[model samples]
Target: MNSTQQWQNVTWFEVDEHQDGQRIDNFLFSRLKGVPKSRIYRLIREGQVRVNKKRIKAETKLAIGDQIRVAPIRYEIKEETDAPVSDKVAQSLLSRIVYEDEGLMVVNKPSGIAVHGGSCVAYGLIEGLRAASGKKYLELIHRIDRDTSGLVMISKKRSTLKLLQDLLREHKIKKTYVAVVKGQVSLDKQLINAPLLRYELANGERRVCVSKDGKESKTQWNVQERFMHGTLVHASPLSGRTHQIRVHGLSIGHPLIGDDKYGHETTYKGPKPRRLCLHAMRLEIPGYAPIEAPMPEDMQSLVAQLRAQKADKVVVSDKDDE
Candidate 1:
């Protein structure tokens, strides 16, 4: 129980002996009597519900003697598909676009914006995209980590969604990324082969982490530039796995510079780039000519600062060599 919770409403439910091992969200969904499932999932996403007095995942299990506190939620019944999202928000979402055509659109998503709204997001990227284009069938073809900035694919038609999904399955499209990490990496290039599994903590959210139990993932990277404070690298993934780049970067001891959730810390020794220093720099489709997008100005400035620092170190080393 939070020391500062002045709950506007509270519902207490006792765990039955039969439901003792069921996931908290599942248990609540079955026993809450009248609340909508959408609202229940949203409550889990928004940190409103508590199990044993600790905020937890929808998948968390209810144990015996656990005190479940359902917080004060204004449960408004609305279609999950028709939640209110406006066109202007979709137009604003245009700033993230990397490439677009009739069949597919690729967006350079920001670090924190979700591609699709789930129970907690309320309004998702597609909701805005739907309002912006006024297209009824717009859909996301693939997934990206919520905290990673990069190329996201969207389909204009349901048939197109299947086509594009097939392309991804066949590895028909190629995506490239650039990431700044905390190291002086010396290797020109290497391949990282690892597997990932969704890891859930006792009371926190779930995240993808490397494990023997995970699915196969592969990544190739080359050190574009190295600095005393870190290394900037170009990344190419052969397989699209959740958090593959971020996890591989961290595994190699060079977590993305500002990825606090995965990278551990944000501040650097030199100039600071405010967001996660990762960018979807290029995309190549099997049939079309390659499309390249340069790093956003914010990330470019940080790279310049790192190179300048590297030059200063080089000058000092050269003078010593002389």
Candidate 2:
């Protein structure tokens, strides 16, 4: 629980022209810095947040000249530091920027770091980048799960953000991931065309599963290496959906190594990977040079082990045939 100071008061905000078409929830999040998203949703649900004196849903769009009322709430406020993020996280994120120009930035996002601050995360990648860049229009172009490390795009201009979003929706942006799975990928090349549905568990955790009534999703995968215990595969998602790559990787009976959400505890028999062995290795935008991220150290170590063991197995097979 937050130890909030009581101020039985309300604050009113007038929507500006530039803020038009923004979701009420997002607008509130931008205004109420350091407040948890759950609390914002609660405020809307309890009729504490009103637009033009009428209760509105979280997804309601804001228009110019509309009045927003926010009831007094308890929240924790932290003092601003020199850096927008902690020193350790800030340094890590700064070092990972692969490409940046006047209107765009690309980063090799590390595993276990959220792209945006939400849920239990206090300050995320975007927040750190914004604090470092001192830019007024920086925003995310797309999102990936916290556990999945890979190429992430950040737009420094609103026009660039809109253009990149349109490209992603049209499947024009080419993104590729390198993943190590528990079993040998049966096909050299395979395409998974499954529909996925997002659902919340009883404990409120979000999860995605394949269902007949879900939205169409497709992923193309090609084997990079076949190991005795696992395989290194390159995966490309044709349709952008939450957990599309992870779930589609599971459909072929080769669940990703260290993927706790969809793979079993006993999934891998080789050296255990430190985290999910998935990396966004490559990204191609229409008007930009292709950006590639090298394999992280942890994944490299695991791959070396797989390669050594695979070599030994091949030698043993040769002797047995003789």
Candidate 3:
């Protein structure tokens, strides 16, 4: 199959086993390079893109042997370029591999590096890994925000992708994160059950908010330590939704300490954190041993500062009258 062919005329794709269960929109995005997502959605909505000769939604999953037809659409050929991945970026990603097997590998993804290429980013962790390792089937099993450093799983085979994704959907895979939130949580353990809805701003930035009409979401938080102005907690999301933990923390008036979005930055008087204080510290799969990533140096420094502040306060309070 000529996956890079420009859709100057009608194009047909027969789904193979490798392509099975992939979303129709994603499939189109790969084939119809340089096309905007809005254009692709419009094509699907207007019935210009069809499966088995019938109109289908963007979320439609493709099955083996299914036929996809795309109507004629002229797109700029020059807009797409084969840019080489940077050696620095590729080596950085390869060195962070914490776990690897015949099926998949886990990477301790650093903050500011995206999982995949999109938006304005030319290439991300996955792209760099693919380029460096020469692996064709590497795919993200789950995603963490670009600013949130954590352990991310990448599948080397399609079957492993399906299995791990199914485990994530069923909540069988446990993911634990450590975060420093703005307020000292009174409760030792708490569960925030709030639904989240994703919306786009007028400027086209995507954001998530807690809305009653949104999808059900839950996050379990346990206070690990308390400071004078902040608290270190372990956050485990019971449901996967866009910005689930960040939004849920905001809903409870304890947003993450360094969250630019959904955070109370002005109210924080402590030293400014370098990045988002959330880290995917631990992951537990049913059949496999737990995978963990140590807290980054910056985060560790922030926690230490908080501890010092708490100690100073205790010393001041315990002093006798002057």
Q: Give the winner by TM-score.
A: 3
For model 1, what is the error of residue 260's alpha carbon versus the real structure, in angstroms, after optimal superposition?
Answer: 1.2
Model 2: lowest-lDDT 10 consecutive positions: 313-322
Angstrom error of the Cα, residue 118, model 3: value is 1.4
- In TM-score terms, candidate 1 sits at 0.69
Alpha-carbon runs more than 4 Å astray in model 2: 1-29, 32-84, 311-322
The sequence of per-residue lDDT tens digits that candidate 3 reaches over residues 270-295 is 77899999999999997899999999
What tens-digit string does per-residue lDDT give for candidate 1 at 137-226? Answer: 566777676666677777765456556666777888888899888766556677878888865555445568889999888888877787
Q: How are the candidates ranked when ordered by TM-score, highest leading?
A: 3, 2, 1
Tens-digit per-residue lDDT, 103-212, candidate 2? 88999999998877755676778888777666776677788888899899987765676678778878999999999998776567777889998766665566788899
**Any runs in candidate 3 off by more than 4 Å, and if so which?**
1-12, 23-60, 69-82, 264-266, 311-322
The global Cα lDDT (0 to 1) of model 1 is: 0.70
**lDDT-better candidate, 1 vs 3:** 3
TM-score, every prediction: 0.69, 0.80, 0.85
